[model samples]
Target: MKMFGLRLLLTVFLLVLLELLVINIAGILPFIASHKANISDAPYMEFITDNLQHPIESSTHMIEEKNPLFFLGSGAVVLFTIYATFFMKGGKGKYELADKYGVHGSSRFAQRHEIFKQGETVGVPAKQLMKDLEASMLVSKGEK
Candidate 1:
């Protein structure tokens, strides 16, 4: 299971990395190619064009080139991938973050019909009451 999760994470990360590379390359190609004639003349534009034209060198290194938006977008992808790779897993158990705080647990509910049969309140089963500490505490505290 752990291996599968790791594979899935790696697959997603690679796909995103590829997507960012493709988009960056595609997006800057036109700008650089269109301005190629004058790119060599403008020092700042040449620098910007070169930076934008390069692929991401490493996970920590990013070349925004000319499109800051695409650079930021790629950064977002990297952040999300890192976060998911470290934190997410494939299972309903992953959604149990709420359980960590004790928001959910064993619980029992009495049917309304069962509770008010013939217009009289029926006592809930003791086992169900014990599942809820509030009910048990109420009974015990009353005696004290």
Candidate 2:
């Protein structure tokens, strides 16, 4: 849970950073456009004047030629972040641990007719889990 919280925080932080980068760059769009087009290039404006151009411009006259690949790439990144942060589940579906283990079971009640499954096992304690593992390994080796 702590790890998940930390990951979510980091994800949010990255999202904010990306948004700030876009907005800050957008904020100085006019200046960037002015400078790149050999206009009155302002001083102390390197913060927004990356060589990488954004299509969303500040002004019309000083249009800085934009790289569509960069825009598309960043847009995709932002879109993915939003989806992963808000829409995606904690670990189910596309990010399911059960999928990794090839487990066909779903912990959800819907797997049953409406609420309950026919052959669901009760939750096992940790000690029982260890014992089960040992028993399963022995059986697999034809010793049990």
Candidate 3:
């Protein structure tokens, strides 16, 4: 739920766009059905019969308004409600938690580095993990 707001915005935009596409396609099918004309050597309008989208506006009428934007908006709202409520959530922040913590954090949380080399700590734990190895080893020896 980190980017819940962003997700809602994107989902709403996409769903509304989808609704618009469906509605427009429903309205525009007749024009596509009509302009069965095409380009071909077989005279005016017979040989190229199978060709789609003639792009002529002679007999095409404007898209009819069967479904209003208000209804479309309402439907989009319902869709978004369903989406935001349950559909997209992934098992209670499974991926979100994994991503929020650095990817290396999950695997390696070094606590008091026991610097082991060649199967042993060489009876020491500080020198190898330090930048100034000689000084660190002396400090470790002094501490011991």
Candidate 4:
């Protein structure tokens, strides 16, 4: 439970970092335009200059194309963070867990439907698959 909480915290921090990355990307000056926008403006004309977002101009963008290793590494980290965060032991289909911790039936109902589907696709015996499907369906009924 403590581990899951920490993982959740890290996931949120990563998301905030991703948002900063997006803002930096948005700050990048356009090299070309659709011809509708004036290209030869105050900067090119000289004497006068204006930036769309001067504050943004200070931040440099990560060049993913030029740095494939960095891109792949960061992407893997982000993906792993996401997987560790919301892949709940908490709830499914409508029946939510009470403790919502990483224990007991905050333990038992852990992704039953998804697990059943994966097992079925991987050729787990049909009888086992059926049992899993039924169990998931039964719990999802929320009748207790």
Q: Distance (Å) between predicted and true CA of 29, model 1?
A: 8.7
Query: Residue 24 error for model 4, in Å?
Result: 0.5
lDDT of model 3, residue 144? 33
Residue 69's C-alpha lDDT in candidate 2? 37
lDDT tens per residue, model 4, 1-144: 998798778878876566445433432333223322766552432211222243234233335234444355457657756775776454363335343434443545545564557546566799999999998988899754
Tally clashes: model 4. 1
Across residues 18-115, which tens digit of lDDT does each residue of candidate 3 receive? 54444444434443445446423324333123222331221122223333443454467667767765587556565556544445547645444334
Question: How well is each residue in 1-144 modelled by candidate 2, as lDDT tens digits?
Answer: 998798789788887667546555444655556578655646635545542254244222123446443455468768978787777777566545543433455553333343344566466799999999999999999996
Tell how far residue 86 is off in model 2, in angstroms: 5.9
Using TM-score, give the best candidate's number: 3
- Please list all clashing residue pairs in model 2, or write none if there are none: none
Per-prediction tally of clashes: 1, 0, 0, 1
Q: How many backbone clashes does candidate 2 have?
A: 0
Candidates ranked by TM-score, best first? 3, 2, 1, 4
Check candidate 1 and list the clashing pairs.
52-65
CA error at residue 141 for candidate 2, angstroms: 33
lDDT for 48 (candidate 2): 53
The lDDT per prediction is 0.59, 0.59, 0.49, 0.51
- Give candidate 4 regions above 4 Å deviation: 30-144
Which candidate, 1 or 4, has the higher TM-score?
1
Q: What are the runs in model 1 whose C-alpha is more than 4 Å off?
A: 1-5, 8-66, 93-144
Query: Model 1: per-residue lDDT, tens digit, 40-120?
Result: 654555544554465444222434345555666666667776666667765667445553333346244545554567857
